[model samples]
Target: MPNTPPSPRRRGTARTDALLQVTLELAAEVGYAGLSIEAIARRAEVGKHTIYRRWPSKAALLMDALHRVWTTDLDHRDTGDVHHDLREQFVRSAAALSEPPIGPVYRAVIAEAQSDPALRAALDERFLHTVEQRTLDRIALGQRTGELRADMDLTFATEILCGGLYYRHLLTTRPVDETAIDNLLDMFMRAYATDPPPPDRG
Candidate 1:
């Protein structure tokens, strides 16, 4: 019996996903700065023109790849308690980062972005912007619910908490464990919780 070929749309999606997956694996192994179109094409078993046809530059391809992997239907439901919700979401994020390829790939992308302006812009526009807006909205919701201090600078507070995660991921080998998450929340509550007394030191 003869086999049927995939439709154009299905074939395109499959190819694109394959390329992105290879890109991420290479990024993890060698860092973004060390990856090249030739390498990606070879690894993906496609010609250079195949990649160049879709993305004009490696940065553009990576931008799309990062968004594809990291910005899909993330869990952001309100749990009625801001601290519980934030901790749950953050722990999930930490766990995702700990997964093979993702952790090193993300860190490599971020590290490369520091020295590459175009990549940095792409990272901010494609990935960071979406996450930051969601975070700000969540913080605003927490304030409205009186869980967070009304006067807290939402952006700055978000930066401190989120920045700490990135810092630990990129700079420190410390595991993003329950203890680490609790410690971060402890600092956050001390600084931003609206309760008169500080949140329990636990």
Candidate 2:
């Protein structure tokens, strides 16, 4: 008997996912300069229409793919220990960087964004904003609960903690490993996350 074809929505989504997957692989290997809709379609084994139907352009497809792989809501807590919670934040954040292709793609995107304002804006809106807002909110929550000092500046704390990875991931060749995460948290705590001292003993 003859086989039935998949539904349009299903087929479209599957093809788009495949295209994005291939795009990510190739982008990591050779950067965005080497990516093209036709190349992606060929690698994904889907027609160009499948990709165009899902994404208006390659930038849209790539941005969506980046978002697709990002793990959301990994750092929400009322654990009452800001130190441990922040440690977990570093650990969870490193999970994204630790993925082999993800790190390269992320690096490439940052480099690509330097010249492409459109891509830069897309990244800011789609990825950077989410990261910034969630981080501020969680740390702010920690502050409200008295886990972090009332005067702790969420902006500076976020920068110091988050900036550590940015330098390692994109600027330097070294990978953002567990040690880096721990050390960063250690320094951050030393500077801003430390506990208050007890009163002098008699």
Strongest candidate by lDDT: 1
User: What TM-score, over all chains together, does every model reach?
Assistant: 0.74, 0.69
Which one is best on TM-score? 1
lDDT of 1: 0.78
* Model 2 ranges off by over 4 Å: 1-22, 41-56, 72-78, 173-175, 194-202
25-64: candidate 1 lDDT, tens digit per residue: 7777777778898999999999999899988888778777
For model 1, give the 10-residue run with minimal summed lDDT.
193-202
Which stretches in model 1 have alpha-carbon errors above 4 Å? Answer: 1-19, 38-56, 196-202
TM-score of 2: 0.69
RMSD of each: 5.4, 6.3
Clashing pairs in 1: none
